[model samples]
Target: MALPTHFDSLYIGGSWVKPIGGETSAVINPATEEVIGKAPVGTGADADAAIAAARDAFDHGPWPKMAWRERAGVLQQLHDALMTRKEEIVQLCVAEAGSIVPVASIMQFDMAMDGLQYYIHQIERREFVTPSSVSAHTNWATGGETLGSTVKVYEPLGVSVGITAYNYPFFLNLAKLGPALASGCTFILKPAPQTPLEALILGDIASEVGLPPGVFSIVTGGADVGEKLTTDPRVDQISFTGSDKIGAMIQAQAAPTLKRVTLELGGKSAMIVCEDADLEQAAFAGLINLTNQCGQGCVLQTRQLVHNAIKGQYIEMLKAMASQVKLGNPADPDTGMGPLISAAQRERVLAFIEQGKADGNTLVCGGTIPPGMDSGFFIEPTIFDCPNNSTAIAQEEIFGPVVCVIGFDTEEEAIAIANDSQYGLSGGVFSQDPGKAYRIGMKMRTGGVLINGGGGRLNPSVPFGGYKRSGIGREYGEEGLNEYLEIKVIDFRAA
Candidate 1:
């Protein structure tokens, strides 16, 4: 499939329109350090137009008034359209997000499709209204009266905006898109400037599927676009996925409007290897940070807390595992790891590595750029042996192919170290004994915990989110569907 040429236009109000400023940003492929595409740079005027379109749709369009089954039919069509373009989506992700082929095939594309299907199923089976039991009440004006019943109605929250990050463009876009549309809300997607092609393609699909005007729109730009979307009172909700720092900014900006905001922010997650855990399984699990999107994922377990009893052997095994990671072009099928999203990101990660060294953390292996790879934004699968968890490397989110190994004396201490961070996203506990792993996982403050690899899969049926500063609301599952809905109760009087 050939790539679309509409990258120069913004998808607003169900039409391909030129940006008001007519500016464009170069989309660089991290692997080759070359311009792969140019995306339209939307201005604040563009954002306002998109918001007005969505608001108009919610107030006067047919989408919110459609029957649940009718909405499901449209969602199913979207799923089919996306599946037919799977190969193209995978290629775009590899080129634009620096996602290696295999990871792009699954995490970037397949998972997103599955998430869409999940929402489709939800639309078909979910009840929008439910009745409550009758109640008796005493009225001062009239005698005692019996109320017939009450019904709780779940209605759409109106116009919603999704500000996505670059790491998982397709998945994050649909993560907000699916639920919002499924719940009968008009959605506006503001994809990250680094990768906007997938979102533009989505707008094309929405058009192909005959999604009503203003039901969906895609506006691509920098922080200015984001500010307009978040602060606009016309937008009833904002769902953002990015760094905690930026998430905090969006939350503050949306405060005046009191928009319903759902933030899936950054994480410094920990993976604990108990004393009685399987050494081989635990060691391989440590590679998740390096191989999964080059550690750009918010939920990747970047912090490894190894029991002191086997800390030395475990570090050796982890170093060996990290050594074997093949870093090269993300287009290469055999490549195990890919480059950071951009040169600026590479420099930011390198600065963290230097700080780690200055803070007295021992460099285990793989810190500098790989030999012979001169052009791309590649970094080695770096690992550090931290003297303590208080160091900058161990505490801050590097968002690169780097991991920190911290030693712990007991399971209690391991839990303490893991819970000590401000982030509480996802966690992992490895142990031969399921009961033991469950016990340790229960004590962690994160939203979700994986035991012994979670079979190396993600369950879309399960809710994904975080605790504390990691994020505010959940994504995926029924709870995610509910995020875009508002509740209302209607009371009736007995005849």
Candidate 2:
């Protein structure tokens, strides 16, 4: 599985084309802080070209007009091609995104392919239009009353721009691509500048599979490329995965065109260890997830709320668990954790730990840099005994290998502490009492909750998104497919 050391062109209009502007940026390896490769910076002109290509394809091309089965055939081809390239994909993902081998192999590569398969399964079983009776009396106020029937049709939402994040670069884009394409929409992907090659390769695969020109395109660049994609009047929808701050800005920018937008943003999700729980199992599970992906996951439980009865024991168990996680090269299969995406990201996480110290939170374990790891952007798995839930350290997203533990007196207080964050993406409650866990899970304010050790499992059929500021709309399941579709009604009485 040899990896390419350079990407010289952007993938647009189903072809590999030179970037309009000559500018290019180097891709840095987080583990080595060295430029591993380079890719062309997508300019505004490139974005316009990609958008125009998608708009034309959606409005007047063969893809949207093809039968659902025909489109599924293309997706199946893609699925097969991706499967053949799995090892290569895994290597590139580990090199470019700083993802540990195990995490990149499954979450970044395997899950991406699984997501495509899920959409194929959905399309195979779905009906594009459903016929149903409509009561004419309900429309009597607008027109003459009569007995009527109508067909509920699901149509593609024309052109869509998928702006993806860097953390799980390929997976996030594939999540958007599988649904949007399965629903018959044309797409333009704006890959994260830091990890654009994987997406560029996706476009290559699409072309090889005979996907129609303009039906799929990838525009590579920085913020200008994103702005052009979002502000373009021709693009009908936007699917974004990144920080909440950037999500809000994208929403605001897309408002003028009234385009539909689905955002999957940041999270500071919680894990509540109830009094009746297995302290050792719960603590170990939560701690491992905190350090998984170097704490870059939006749904990882970073805030741990333990019942006071077992707080001391849980902390001891959690510290011991954190001490075992080895941070080093992402390319190493045995490395439990890897470097932050960049030196700047490491600094940001350090600042948050500094804030925790300033706020009087007790440092429990692994706050400083790891020994002998002087070159890479690395941080030891850190945990702090937060003073209360009100502190920023407990409530805000710290996108690094750091967890904050808070003690709670009652179930009511535990729930309150968990719900206090601006994010409500995913959470968990660990308890021996099934009844109590179910009751608590039902009351949790997040989009998805895991009762006991249930947070990390990957089931593509389930809807994945957040509540409140965490994000808007869902990304998987039937709900995810619906995000790229529009509903219309055809009246038989009028005919």
Candidate 3:
């Protein structure tokens, strides 16, 4: 991979400048294992500068006072600039995020464009908001006094810290950024250490659109920078998409400050396949969700709840499809699966594979590395049929291309086993019987459910989030924007 020296240096208060320390972090092409570019190696002081910039933008700048129509125009401009660089963004994201080249490119660019359009349409459709509650008194209408509380105004909250994970860096950035920015709140995004280039590109687009300085900033760094951003007093909200352990820690740290927090944490989502389901369709959906994206997605159907009547047949179908998943180089367009994020993650996946074997699960497909692919962080798409739900593989989030298949006797049993995990993110149920699908979907308690054939890819209009341990708050819709806003009621005194 060729390294690009001319990259987004750092977008600070209305200006792009070099890092204060003059240090940089190398971005890698996860697929080809080469240095691609460098993002600023931000420090605690840099975080302070970003926060101060956001605070000034919020408290004393025109961005906060700008009319809604003007603000909407700014967002539209940002969308247009991003769309123009759609292909470039795809290439950058694929190189940085290891998403199998063009597929990753499509997701980073085309999908984000769709989300931006969603925001534009959604904001345009809303009428002026009226207050839900009002107080009126007979004596209220004194000399030159107003009679009734006319409206409830929504105010943008202060600055927000948006920390994205590596697996879906570009998508995650837009998922949080769209709602936060559309709500009129300023934001500073901290991309994951593994993939910061996508966020950098997004920051560059913001600059290109003349997004007011202090309104949006991108400071790329590791755990230290993330900690500084989360703990800082200037930031009013913290929205993070990552592991549950880190989510808990941030929650604890942010409690003393009383900062508003939104977390889209980890999940062990399940896909239940009932006996009444069309075997072919259910199996296909199951494998696609799990194996595609190399099984790094959080809402993927990692647990396959198969009815005992069709367990054998379903396993056979799953095996055939799994074998067809071509794995070698992500740069190859035909490659079905890509490598995990890093060598440590690859080793982690390997340990879980060993654990599954020790727990007496039946290993069906892909337990070792792909042929001619031992250099990069690659793992085989693994499937395990554990007779009991108590197995380690069923209990843990492997965060790799490994899935667990558990047999169930009844609908109730399937739901029970599926809901047994700590995660309630995204899930699905496949059944030709509409009643059964609806019934099971209603009972699953996940954030999103695909009855029969719905996929994880969502439109910008749809609200996406998780429940229970899976996540907090929503992303991508009207309600999502509201999450970043503070409701304020202004009582009129003059007639």
Candidate whose lDDT is highest: 1
Candidate 2 per-residue lDDT over residues 104-140, each given as its tens digit: 8999988888899999999989898999965656455
Q: Candidate 2's C-alpha lDDT? A: 0.88
Tens digits of per-residue lDDT, candidate 1, 1-495, equal 575834789999999999999998888889998988888999999999999999999999999999998999999999998899899889999988999998899988888888989999988988889989887787667876656788999998899999999998988998899999999999999999888887888877889899999999999988898999999999999999999999999999999999999999999999999889899889898887656898899999999999989989999998888888888998999899988998999999999999999999999998899999998899999989987899998889999988998999988999999998999998999999999999999999999998998866677787999999999998999899889999999988865
- Model 1 vs. true fold: TM: 0.98
lDDT (0-100) at residue 157 of candidate 2?
A: 80
What's the true lDDT of residue 441 in model 3? 91
Clashing pairs in 3: 131-152
**Candidate 2 TM-score, true structure as reference:** 0.97
- Tens digit of lDDT per residue, candidate 3, span 303-388? 89999999999999988998888876677778888788888888889999998998899999898877787577888889888897
Compute the lDDT for candidate 3.
Answer: 0.80
Lowest summed lDDT over 10 consecutive residues: which window, candidate 1? 139-148
Worst 10-residue stretch by lDDT in candidate 3? Answer: 1-10
The TM-score obtained by model 3 is 0.94
